[model samples]
Target: MTQEDPEIQILLDQAEELYSSLLRGETTLADATCSEILIKLETAIEKKKHELKQTSKTSQLC
Candidate 1:
C-alpha cells in the first residue's frame, strides 16, 4: 500500500465510527439532520475510496 493508504483507512474507520454513533443516538449536531450527516459521511467515504484507488494506480506505475 502507498503511504497515503493508511491515512485513508483511518478516515474510513472514523467515518464508520461516526455512523455507528449516529445509529446509537450518540451523536448530536445542532444544525444538521441525521440524513444530512449520513450523506456527508457517504460522500467522504467515496472520496477516500477514490483517493485510495488513484494512489494504488500511481504506485503500480512506479
Candidate 2:
C-alpha cells in the first residue's frame, strides 16, 4: 500500500458513512443534493480503484 491507498480508503470510509446516513432515511436534502454528492463520491472511488490497479501493474513490472 502507498500513501494514496490510505487516502482513498479514508474517502471510501467517509462515503460509506454518508451512505449509511442516506440509507437511514434521515437526510432532508433534495434529489439534486443527494445525486450530486453520491455521484462525486462514486466517481472518486472508481478513479481511486483504477489508480490502484495501475499502480499494482506498474509495481509488478518493476
Candidate 3:
C-alpha cells in the first residue's frame, strides 16, 4: 500500500472519533465545524467502501 494512503485512513478514523465525541456532547465545537470533519470522514469512508465493493465484485466475477 502507499504511505499516504495510511495517513488518509488515519485521518478518516480520527474524524469518525471526533464525530462520535460530538454526538455524545464531548466536543464543544459548533455544528458546522463538527460537520466538516464528518463530511470528510464520510467521503473517506465512501472511497474505502467503493474499493471494497469493487474487490468483492471482481472476486465474484472471477
Best by TM-score: 3
Candidates' RMSD to native: 5.6, 4.1, 4.7
lDDT of 3 by residue, 21-58 (tens): 87899887786384766677667767877997999999
lDDT digits (tens) for residues 1-62 of candidate 1: 32545654555566677767767778755322455545655666688788879989999999
lDDT of 3: 0.73
Per-candidate count of clashing residue pairs (backbone under 3 Å): 0, 0, 0
* Model 2 Cα lDDT, one tens digit per residue, 1-62: 32656655665666677767767886555643566556766677788788879989999999
Give Cα distance to truth, residue 35, candidate 3, Å. 3.1
- Model 1 gets an lDDT of 0.64
Highest-lDDT candidate = 3
Q: What would you estimate as the lDDT of candidate 2? A: 0.68
Per-candidate TM equals 0.48, 0.52, 0.53
